[model samples]
Target: MFTEAQLYSPVTRTGDGDVTVHLSTEHPGVHDPAYRARRNAIAACALEYTSGAPTPRIAYTEAEEQVWRTVSIELARKHRGLASAEVLAAARRLALPTDHIPQLDEISAALTPLTGFRYVPAAGLVPLREFFGSFADRIFHSTQYIRHHSAPLYTPEPDAIHEIIGHATQLASPRFAAIYEAAGAAVARLRTDAALKFLADVFWFSLEFGVLREHGEIRCYGAGLLSSYGEIDEFRRAELRPLDVFAMGTGVYDITHYQPILFCAESMSEIEDVIGAFFESMDDETPLRARHLPTHANVPVAQ
Candidate 1:
């Protein structure tokens, strides 16, 4: 079975600059020729792009627009009750359209004013170093394809929904943007694969899937949970442990399933102090030392 990362990043370019998106048999779009063609067309747009140029635009089909509309309306309803106040405020400021799929350039235009962040197209997997390192420059590499329309609320891989709705809203916040840049800077300072993986794992736990306490509720701040229809409803049921960098950096998780364990912050300030500080100070030796530290005891799972 393909790892979740591999599943999401199935596009590859050949020596001659041709783009091919390999869909696993389990992928919903694998048997659909129309969906496959659309994936190729969208990936080609990213393949043909040059940095600092206008982000490409896609004329989304009515079906595609409907998918976006369905997800946007549903996620908005869930966010009001499950998302962190910081995320809710950022979403309001970003003001993404609920009736149509907003082009990446439009998303960039909004983000640039808020936090100096901009979007660049990715045909698929950007190398780990480049992906994380680009955060230092306020650049986000995003995929442009929507998921197969048959299951609007279920995607086997990260789609445009995950890129724009999941990440763009979080990027709208200055504090979250600062944390992203810090992670990018930490990636630049690291020298080993081990250290990079450690940083990525920490990032996965915190920014991609982190949660925090707000107004007596365990609300979501992580883009992974925020963008996920099912995950938004299920995260509070996961084991909610306190933030522990050592554990977060060294922990193992299966991205394909609802995460069974999560690290929660006492507040947004705690996220900054713990996750932000770790990213700012991390280096090649950090994970080495972290591995030797005793793990924090798990807190009682959220009721």
Candidate 2:
């Protein structure tokens, strides 16, 4: 998966409440003058926004709305059979608009009551510290831009669809929202970059692309897997291993394609007991603790 920062624009806020979001030209879609202007407009609107302030609405183009409808309709069907019950329940609670692109405010209205989580806008890449730390306050920094229209089903970076559809649904559940808050607390307590990176890796594997065994079948609970149209089907074919904290924190893998390896828990209760417990107890010593332990590929924890 892409590094956390690469998926969001870097945002800077001034003491006087002035905000500047610097969009990267690295993505070719951003090269379009019209798209760039739309992105900038949304970022500007976000700058003027404050907590409890009304979310700024973007006037989406017809092309963008069509993209939203296409992905929304297809992902809904795909999610029914593949997504975890937790994700499905949250999706029902959110009741996200399918016929048109939803404004960030609409998402916040649905999510805030359920889990105290709300969305904030980003231009391109949000710094890892601010990005993860915001979770402590139940805030999610998201990009307002849509993916390039040419390929609505795929985006090299996390777009509005990924951020809103994938993450917002996950955030809607109090159970999963608590994990996010715990992860944020973990980041706040860490003193070293390595420790933070380890946390990020753990999050990438578990929250972003994690899976769990439900009954006799393997199902996806991770946002990355839940939102993806293609990879969701391919994930079951990858190497599925038991959930291991050490392996997840230290594992190195390629992001240019579907993950060849994924960690799975026996059930949702196992997810809460094991992964949830890990998040609740982590501290500055976590890195040293992992390093001191034997190099085991996959250590089974009694679930």
Candidate 3:
């Protein structure tokens, strides 16, 4: 969730280089006549996060420290709640030194041993390809900051707590970790705009906002939705949807509001099964894609 527009705008180029859609974050704020006088022409919202738009870095405000502390402590405690076989238990093993707040440095020191990839502290969102490409190498694109507690059950944006405490802990499971890496590799190679959007759906619905089904019971798994107080109760026992045996269906998810529906997999092994299907479903031809496509390919670019 970025603070405002007029600093960085998402400008889409049409067939001949005409501006299509834009969520401007120009320096002038929204007071300029172009935005204020021509109010109806004002493009998107203040915290616009579209599939193709660049994910802006959100440097946590000075006021957010206390909230970060609250969430972190809770999740740290949550690591103990899961069964010894669960991913959270693995995260407990991966938990390294925290310097006041948990630094990416500390987290990586633990993760680097298991996987070649490390955590990268970022501002807002990384480009879609980079987000996946980093993962392709096992590197995790993480936001270095946390969301305030009052943030409507945690927005879909990957905040600091969401990354380090929420998602990184789950990364401890090698199989789940590999699925993340392979999925990133797939997204990196898919290259087309439509494919990237589909990857975003994977990240959103599964990695960030996914659930798991053990026996007949469903449980929260993904951090983006797990950090939420609003969603946890609804999805845990709810049907959500019958999960694809592979990571097939999470390719076109929606954010900016509560997810009315969720998707659940039976296990991490199931996650691998779905992702393996993703590989089989596509023919490799990513690099050939143009940087500036003439049309939307239904793939998402930025997270």
Model 1 TM-score is: 0.96
lDDT of 2: 0.80
Tell me which of candidates 1 and 2 scores higher on TM-score.
Answer: 1
Write candidate 1's Cα lDDT for 1-303 as tens digits.
Answer: 113366474777789877789988888888999999899889999989999788899999999999999999999999999999999999999999999999999999999999999999998888789999999999999999998999999998888999999999999999999999999999899889888888888888989899999878899999899889999999988998888888887787787789989898989999999899999999999987877866673665454
Q: Which stretches in model 2 have alpha-carbon errors above 4 Å?
A: 8-31, 48-52, 294-303
Candidates ranked by lDDT: 1, 2, 3
Tens-digit lDDT track for model 3 on 1-303?
Answer: 211122223444356534333324422323344433222221222124333344433333444556666655654554344222366656666763333455565677778777655776554545767766777778776655443334523443445666766667767767667767777667645746655655555556777667766555555667654455455545554335545422333233335455655666667677667644554344344212323324332322221
lDDT of 2 by residue, 25-137 (tens): 66656667776666666667766667677677888999999989999899999899988888899999989999998888788888999999988776667667788888999
Best by lDDT: 1
Which of candidates 1 and 2 reaches a greater lDDT?
1
Q: Evaluate all candidate structures by whole-model CA lDDT and list the values in order.
A: 0.90, 0.80, 0.52
Per-model TM-score, in order, reads 0.96, 0.88, 0.64
* lDDT winner between candidates 1 and 3: 1
